[model samples]
Target: MPIVQVEMLEGHTLAKKRLMVEKVTEAIVESLGVPADKVTIIIRDMSKENFSKAGKLACDQ
Candidate 1:
């Protein structure tokens, strides 16, 4: 089984996430020759306030 982890800022709709996972699964299946059921996807939704870049909080930017 292949596991994929994705982390992005929160605010995406369920439809977008569903499409993203579908595409990701297709890619993994094609590259690894693995079944779709064998691919695992873990999505982490992060808050902008908890993320920062270049000494500036994401929420501040």
Candidate 2:
């Protein structure tokens, strides 16, 4: 089994997240020759305040 983790600022719709996971699973399955069911994906949705870039908080951008 392969584990993949992705973290992004919150605000995406369920449809987008579902599509993202589907594509990610497909890529993992094809690359590792593993079953889709055996691939593990972890998606973390964080608040803008919790993420930062260029020495500034995302919420402040």
Relative to the true structure, how large is the alpha-carbon lDDT of every model?
A: 0.96, 0.94
Candidate 1 stretches with Cα past 4 Å from truth are: none
Decoy 2 TM-score against native: 0.90
The digit string of per-residue lDDT tens for model 2 on 1-61 reads: 8999999889999999999999999999988899999988999999999998999999899
- What TM-score would every model get versus the actual structure? 0.91, 0.90
Q: Candidate 1 lDDT, tens digit per residue, 1-61?
A: 9999999999999999999999999999999899999999999999999889999889999
lDDT, model 1, position 47: 98
Model 1 is weakest, by summed lDDT over 10 consecutive residues, at 48-57
Candidate 2 all-Cα RMSD: 0.9
lDDT of 1 at 22: 100
